[model samples]
Target chain A: MKYLTYILRNARRNPARTGLTIASIAISMFLMMILTSFFAAMQEANSASRQYNRIIVMNANGFAGVVPIARVRQIAAMDGVVAATPFAWYGGKYQNQRVLFAQFGVDADSVFDTLEEFHLPDDQLAAFKADKAGAVVGPKLAREYGLKIGDAMPLQGDVYPVDLKLNIHGIYESPRNSDQRMVLFHHDYLDDQLRLLGPSSSSGSSATQPSGRAGNAGIVFVRCKDAAATAALCKKVDDEYRSTDNPTRTQTEEAFGQMFSEMMGGMKDMVFWIGCAVVVSLLFVAGNAMAMAMRERTMEIAVLKAIGFGKGLVLTLVLVEAVLVAGLGGALGTLGSKALFDLFDVSPYTGGFLPFFYVPWRVALAGLGVSLFVGFVSGVVPAVMAAGSSVVDGLRKVV
Target chain B: MSAPPSIELRGVEKEYRRDEFVVPVLQGLDLSVADGEYLALMGPSGSGKTTLLNLVAGLDVATRGQVIVHGQDLGRLSEGQITRWRADNVGFIFQTYNLVPVLTAAENVELPLLLTKLSRKRRRENVATALRVVGLEGRERHYPRQLSGGQEQRVAIARAIATDPFLLVADEPTGDLDRGTADEILELLEQLNREFEKTIVMVTHDPLAARRAGRILHLDKGRLVDDVINDSAAAAG
Candidate 1:
């Protein structure tokens, strides 16, 4: 406690060098946290999916292929299945701008059952089920676009032959951020338009095309009766469809989330290595600054020893000052990163992957730990050298 | 019964190893100082004056002989024990007034007392008393850079005496000061010796500075060439 003033004074001895070193560490740590946050987002997604025993049943070709809508009924009647719904992606444009929030043609009545986390009032849910054109927007999407219950949400088709004129009937709130950023309407309404406008009518793909993607579901979401039965049910569904024309692959919701992470697994490693490179670069920056600061204090250190300060005390003070500088920078970086994600909605920039990009306390703590480690590494050599140096030579060097 | 000398060196030989070669600085140097004695060392450059002072102050080890200060054999003590002994018994004043530039005068004075078990209030009181004794009562908050050359040396003296060590070893204590400031510093040293009875060993090149000491020893080529007793200087002090 008595030595704190001396240590802090020494840390602030050269304001320019200390500020530069701190800035270097802060920038490096911010970049590292940004990269780590990507993986944290994926983990958060999987963690949310694991809360319920849900399985995603997609066609063999994944999103490129569509499953027959009749399979939802067949899966719902399966032994361990509790509820099932057809979930299809609608690539649409709104107000001549690309829709940032996801638009999906979901079975409105059963989607509320499958995604039980989304909270909609009983009246709002009934209103959505009564009208085919009624749509429910997630709270996050409503907040982003200032959408109200009676707002006319018109979506121009990008992937289908017909457009949708949907009226927002409900906005769902969920504890999970990702689940509350989607727009879901009755699949029957979209199917009615798809059948009316054949493949060649509006999209002008081909005039003689006999078949279209009508009455097809992009994916089937199944809620199992028990969590432990999901793996077995996924295998049963995939094996049963293996020999059929419309083959399918079924996976637990968490596993489905992991599939996207696996797609980005190699990139995560690259980003991690880049973060490592950033830390290494900061090590040198901090090391050089510490070396210079220690060198400047060489004579004062000798004077301290002459006045009876032990080598151990000197070493501790030097290392502690280094850590103090680094810890301040780390704390600043965390605040900066948190403020950025908090003050602005990065949903528009994350490609809908991370709508709520708040940095977890664990990741912030990890960054601070890394800062302390860098401090210890960078200060050890110079501190040991300073403490172990000959006092006579040091005093005489300046004398 | 007579007490032992405050400092005694019996055939102390000090050498430095530079790579493989051995450079001898002090050879078979035998010296002793009675309690409360004021002595000064004078010599040309590379004459072992400062080396002998270092040996007596326990800053360096004797290569082949015994250096006993305050009745403890420094050569037999470990590094830790010698440091504690130095802190308890000896005070040092450097030629360059080596107070930490960042610390104020009071903080600099309080530095040595930090080694003791003294409470913070007591340490502050001791620092104030030390600074007061040096005639710098109101300058406690001034940094080394803020003070003049002589004031800085006075603050260094206050720091040296803050723990109330009985002995003070100063190497060229006034080397960087002007003659007026040097005289002021020398007078302060004489007052400390006459009033407080501190055993002071000083190394100086100025003849005028040496005259302020009760005794002066001249060294040349690693040997004590002459030891002079300045009775008038003792009387003057």
Candidate 2:
């Protein structure tokens, strides 16, 4: 009890240093929490969208572009391809806003049937089917465009030369996959638009030729009978398309997600380096604060030591004071970071890639653990110096 | 067992080496203090009065001889054992009061009792009794900073007697106080000596304070030069 009082009194004596130390700890913890939460949220979204039983076949050259719809059909006819859908890449700009988003033209029925994540209401589904030029936008994109159920959106395609007039048939939202903001239109609309804008059969060029179907569909989604059959099915599909004009690369849904994540190499490296630097800098700040506090309280520590307080007791007193300050700071920082997320919207506009900023529990727990460890590490040297001081010398010290 | 001599020093010597020189503080000094004796040591600055007092109080070590207090040789004990012996057998009153500034008078008085196996209620009772003995029961909650110099010294006295030790060792207990406060402290010490029968060995430079003791021992350098018993004290009815 005496030791506790002594610790509290000492902690109270230097309010400025203690407050600064706590602030440093809080900020570091908050940053760590934010970074970890951001990454973990991305992983959860990826995991939610990734269908393990499905196989995604892309260009063998490994890049984002169009593959022929004929190629998609061939891959669909392969064995173990219970269902397959052609998904074309449409990088579109809305109303010249300079904000880029994903747009995919799929066989809407087959897409809704094969990919379970594209869940929409029956009315919205019917609306999408009734209108040939109709499109469905993710909830975030719909909100950004201020589009209602019947709003007509003029979207400019980045790769194709056609400007599309798409009616907003429905708004799609998924807590996990809701981050994928895209406009999905009917594949027939794109195919007809291309035919209308191209040379006709009277010119001795078939409009339905492979060259005319160049941008028909760049990707195909194939679902195997079961998860265990996906690997063999992927190899079989790749082997079947290996001799075709447009060869294919097949991978499981998870591997495709990992490939997308690996695309942002620069951002991932920046996150790693920034995290390391922040933690190291915080440790230095915390260490300095503890050292200064210990130096200023030398006389008080000496007095306690002189009056029959054991060395261990004195050390514990100082360390407990540090831990109290740091732990309180960490808890406040975590809570404050959460509150900050609520009060201020800091979601990065990284080309519509992420949504819903948060602080993960693992990150919070790790931050707290680091704060405690820093408190102990920083206080140890100073506590030892105070405790090991000679009683006679301590008594002689004026301050 | 018989009543212990409270403090005993036999051929005790203290020496300090300065660079290449060996300086002796106490040279082969021998003394015995009775159970309830009130003794004072006085001499010049370089005299061994403080050194001898420290030896008797078990606060310092002897280079060549035994410092026995209440039948235990202080030289043979470990640091922890010596601290325990000091807490058990001797109390100290310093010139500076040495009260922890953060603690109240009552808490300061309760410090020595921490070394004892007394319960909290019993400790509180004993602290109250000690404060009453020093006439500071009314100011029990006053901090050291809140009290006057004289009041702080009285609190120090309360702390010294809190554990009911066999002996009290004071080094210039009145050195920092004014004449009136010094006289009050002296009266308190005399009362303790008379009423409680606590043997006291006080080191002082004040001749008047020295004159109040039952015996005054004068020293030059490190050896005792004069030892005299006060005739009035001996003849007191």
Candidate 2 Cα errors over 4 Å, as ranges: A35-55, A67-89, A100-107, A110-122, A129-154, A158-160, A176-227, A260-281, A342-345, A348-353, B15-25, B33-60, B79-237
Candidate 1 — which residues are off by over 4 angstroms? A199-211, A351-353
Chain A TM-scores, one per candidate?
0.94, 0.84
Flag clash pairs in model 2: A67-A218
How many steric overlaps does candidate 1 have? 0
Write candidate 2's Cα lDDT for A1-399 as tens digits: 644655665666667877877887887778777766676656666676555478888878765434567666676676776777888765667888654567878877666666766678889988998888998887766766577889998878655656678898988765533444678888878777666666543234332342365455777887766787789978887787788766778898777777777777677788878877876776677767877887766655654554455577677877787777777788888777766775654443665555456665556667777777777777787778877876544544331
What CA root-mean-square deviation does each model show from the true structure? 2.3, 5.2
**Winning candidate number (lDDT):** 1
lDDT (Cα, 0-100) at B103 in candidate 2: 77
By DockQ, the best candidate is 1
True contacts kept of each: 0.49, 0.02
Query: Could you tell me every candidate's TM-score relative to the true structure?
Result: 0.95, 0.78
Local error of candidate 1 at residue B209 (angstroms)? 1.8
Question: For model 1, which pairs clash?
Answer: none
DockQ scores of all models, one per candidate: 0.65, 0.21
lDDT of 1 by residue, A1-399 (tens): 999889988888899999989998998888788889778866777877887899999999778677888888989889998889998788788787766668888888788788877789999999999999999998878887899998999999877757999999999887744656788998989888888875445443321121356778889999998899899999999998899878999999999988988899899899888978877887888889999998988898888877777889888988998888988888778667866866766776766666566666678888888998888888888889888887787888544
